[model samples]
Target chain A: MQTYSLKCYKCNVTQNDNSISRIFCEKGCNELLICEDISPMKQDPLQSMRDDEESFSLGEGSTPLIPLNKIGKRLGLEKLFAKLEFMSPTGSFKDRGSSLVINIARKERVAEFVEDSSGNAGASLSAYAGATDIKAHIFVPDSAGKGKLDQISIFGAKLHKIEGPRENSTIAAKDFSKKNNIPYLSHNLSPYFSEGMKSFAYEIYSEFGEVDHIIFPTGNGSLLLGTWRGFIDISENSNLSLPKLHAAQSSIIEPIVAEFSQKKWNFDPSSKTIASGISVSNPPRLIEIVDAIKNSNGSATSSSDNEALIWHEILAKEEGIYSEKTCAFSFATLEKLVKSGIIKKNEKIIIPITGSGLKETT
Target chain B: MQTYSLKCYKCNVTQNDNSISRIFCEKGCNELLICEDISPMKQDPLQSMRDDEESFSLGEGSTPLIPLNKIGKRLGLEKLFAKLEFMSPTGSFKDRGSSLVINIARKERVAEFVEDSSGNAGASLSAYAGATDIKAHIFVPDSAGKGKLDQISIFGAKLHKIEGPRENSTIAAKDFSKKNNIPYLSHNLSPYFSEGMKSFAYEIYSEFGEVDHIIFPTGNGSLLLGTWRGFIDISENSNLSLPKLHAAQSSIIEPIVAEFSQKKWNFDPSSKTIASGISVSNPPRLIEIVDAIKNSNGSATSSSDNEALIWHEILAKEEGIYSEKTCAFSFATLEKLVKSGIIKKNEKIIIPITGSGLKETT
Candidate 1:
């Protein structure tokens, strides 16, 4: 069996373990960490190649890079591409990671898994769990969409709805994990999980050799960071340069943006957004997210709820990609960035619509 | 260019036209029809094989044959399999037929296409239209799920929401087609449309070889009739017998069941059910649906709305397949059949979960 180690992002402490789910510092430290032993080559090369032949396996990756022809023309851009990630197996890109995560856990003889999600992550985790015949216990916010809750239930996951706010779910899940002595496969903390997102970057690179800029709807920053990592890996191992990374967020939860613009790292926990997936008040991966943005010579931008809704309608009506409000945030931010002369109209841009609108939303 | 003759399904009238859009008896006769050229099998020996490959385009066909182990045991059945058909590109099994229908239309230089759907069919048609860049106009019931409507609009298809019952959408779409002189690719009446469904039967045969019985969640009977035709073709081409066919419906819309039990060819339009997909009171292919059941020594069964809801929850919880209420109706009816000794406990049963539950419902 393959053994792994957990390395705390903050403390830089590593703990060796044979478990696939150790994803953070010890209880006393309570610091963000990542599972190691796997190289950050964007994906398990063997698994990526084998996935092509798996007939019965859930179709999880290789989402379409739809041309935003109408929307791009309207926004005065030459060309814009929206990577539709919501079309994944469980209606979210998280399935890409969850599939690999669960497979690894199963291979390591893990019988049960636990996680916390705003909605999409939980549903994806539950689905992959069911597929692999592993017992899944998911903690979700009480205010999570009913459709998402119903979907998780359908997958036979034991769901625990935590009250208060979205962050409370994570707290509850952590407490439960400690009490039950079960592994907490934190989607937010697991480096291996984010490694699954490298497929998105590889796909973009394969389709378009080099995008001038790649924008993402950010929450936990897994997508933003993972994609940057993927492009960076390609630049190191292959003959390609990394695209500039731009992170989009709702104005209601602009903590990372504020910190980026001010060059300060003060923590705040009162931020919130209607984009439930990115409503994170304080993302644990904030440092890596900032590093990705700065390293790529990109900046962070925030769009108001009204702006997000406006772009949501435009994306559906004009571009013909029926994405959720959060996805629209990226478009709105991109338009704003262009109008303010931050991003040029001539640049080739890529935006990832992270989740599907077909799933539950208010 | 290959020229083909067009024939009406109702009048058996034929016309030679180099165009693909003009197929039907006349303006007044709303029967479905197709245009094709007659040729020796040897002339296009690969025609059948090409058609087979095109029909079973790896992405669309051979969906998961998931064992309903937990649900079947509870219902006193030794084995049960759900042919998950919603995993198609457009999130519905209708893609199978829509793909073939649209491709053939495109091959014949059809510029525009029109179709009417309760929901699933419209979504499927919209996706194929987008893929082929064909002008697609779809008429859908005003009460169609928001998710489905959103999908149609997102595919750049012109959507006309008609008020009234589900059947009104078809009437309105036909009127629109006649007014514009465009081909109406009506799934309900189109032989080519149902021909796509033959892939489903082939998928089953590939998986189980031959099951003891197969049940359908029947609406317009496209799936039932299409699979039956495939089986019949297989029986004629290969040395094999067909499986017993069972048509399942909701008690409120038990027109087919009522006709089958009484051996009468009468149907009442006033009947209704919450299983909107299967709530057909006047199925155009009624005779063919009856023939399919009669020829296989099979029967029809119906379940109440409450039973369907119960089964929906049970299937989701037990089998981890989140299907719509209509899909669950088949399982509910299956349970009733098994309880009444109509379905033997030891028999291998196949039930197709027709569509996804991602769409919103009342």
Candidate 2:
């Protein structure tokens, strides 16, 4: 068994036990739990998070990393690639996190759980929960996409659609979890969930040997932080330097970008963007996300709804990549990076196509 | 550089050249063409169909082959596997075929082409055609799902909504192609499209060492026929034997099943099923499909729409696999096979989840 501990990044307090209830720090720091100090373990990276028998999957990882030939030429980059993360079983990258989170839940003998999401994570969690015969109560904003809502319900998860903003759904979910005594298995805060995303970084390393940069479609920053941790894990005894992990968010909700760039930005309730996946007013993992960006010497940028939609269409019509609208944030960011001479034309860059276009209604 | 010839199954007529126009045998054998005399090629299997430079991919192959433990237990089978073929670039197994068809079209310097599909193939071909910058006129039935139609147009394909039965779309597409001087790249009839599906079988062999049986959700039998050919390719000069390739279809449209069982059955225009992907009344490759099943010592069976939906739900709620309703046909067929003692509980079986449930509207 791989030995690891859940340590609070803020308080630096470590807990060796694997429990779903240990979400935040016991020091009242309210920071998310993270796997900090770990013994150099087996070659199997999945063992870094969950046990062998506890390893559950819906064929989540090993997504395709294809060269974006047409999109690259248009963006003035000679080597731009897209990791088709949306080609997952549930048609999103959340499957990776869900696999780990639900696996841990199963290992801990948890019977039920509650999770909140705009859409992707809820559907993903519901799917995994169904596989394990664990009842799931997914709370989503009433405004979540019809496709995602349908997907959530299809997996036999009890749907709890809350009114108003995405935060309302989260609040309602937490209340339900506390009231019903169900474990709140939030993908954002769960260390195992983020730990599952480490597979993405490892896959990129294996496929490309070395990547110059990776611009993610950021929301709560689970993927970003996990990828950073993943790169760190791989770079333990090697001369390999971590890739510059860039963050691309919607201008409407650019908490990570604002913090990284030291710009004054606030939540605007009225603001809406086509990139609904990253429409987060407040991300709980803001500190870790910002730290990763700063530590990797990566930049954070935001794009408007119009710019995002334009890139989304270009990905479909030009490159035949029918990714979710949120994916365009990375392309919009890439264009700016190219024009500003931050990312050179010859350097290899990767963008994760986070979700499928099929998940988004036209 | 991989030498091959398009040989008519019935007439013994062979064409050495690769041309999109030569779909049928010139000697009035209305039979579909197949790659017959393929020379022993290099190490790469992709080169068997298309040249290295002409190869196009949206990362279509290498789908997850996961063991269906829960569903297998329910079906009294100890070893049942599901090849999540729906985890393709276009959310369907058709992408494998589409990759080759479009690649061949691009190599032939075809600027424009017309194709007809129920939904999956059109969306798949549209995406590939978009990637290659080829103008595609996709004729789909007006009754096709809204999700599929949206997907077709999203890739910038000219969507021709044909009225009446699915046959109407094929007739309209062919007529349009003839009038516009564009090659009709029909996914059903194109040898290149079916040739591309050979990869599916090769992948299964690589993953499982050897599969005892494979149940395909049959439409035009592209996947089924190609998989058989793939096994034949690998079994050449070896002790390896081809797996029993079974065909599963909707009872509403059971042409192959009726013919295989020597039952008197005919197509009914009013017949409808939720499994829209396999609602082919008249499969042009019927003869070849029957031949493959018989030669491989496989059976052709079908299930009712009610049964299909039940299996579809069982897969989602029980197995946590949210696949299209068409995939249920395989499960329904499997149940029948198990009950009839044709498929022993101990033998390994594989079913391809051909498309994503996200593509289906609730």
Tens digits of lDDT, candidate 2, A1-362 = 34457988887888655587678887787777896536665232454443465567788888988889998898788999999999998989998888877877888899999899878898899999999999999999897778888999999999999998788888998999999999998887788788878888888877777788999999888888888988897797567778999999998889988898789998889877887888887888898899999899999999998998899899999889999999999999999999999999899999999999888855
- Which residue pairs collide in model 1, if any? none
What TM-score, over all chains together, does every model reach? 0.78, 0.97
Using Cα atoms, each model's DockQ against the true complex is 0.25, 0.78
**For residues A1-362, what per-residue lDDT tens digits would candidate 1 score against the true structure?**
12335677677777654356666576448776654434444343224634444322355666666566667788888878877776565667887677667767767778887899878888888876775678899998887778888888778899999998777888898899889988898888887687667667877877788888988888888878768767876677677867889889887777689777974444345655567768776888888788789999998998888888888877655444556678888888898889988778888999887876777433
Q: Candidate 2 residues B47-93, lDDT tens each?
A: 44434655677888888888889988887899999999999999999
Which candidate ranks first by TM-score, i.e. highest? 2
Model 2 residue A252 CA deviation (Å) reads 1.4
Q: Highest lDDT among the candidates is held by which one? A: 2
Question: Which residue pairs in candidate 2 collide?
Answer: none
Expressed between 0 and 1, the share of native interface contacts present in candidate 2 is 0.75
State model 2's lDDT.
0.86
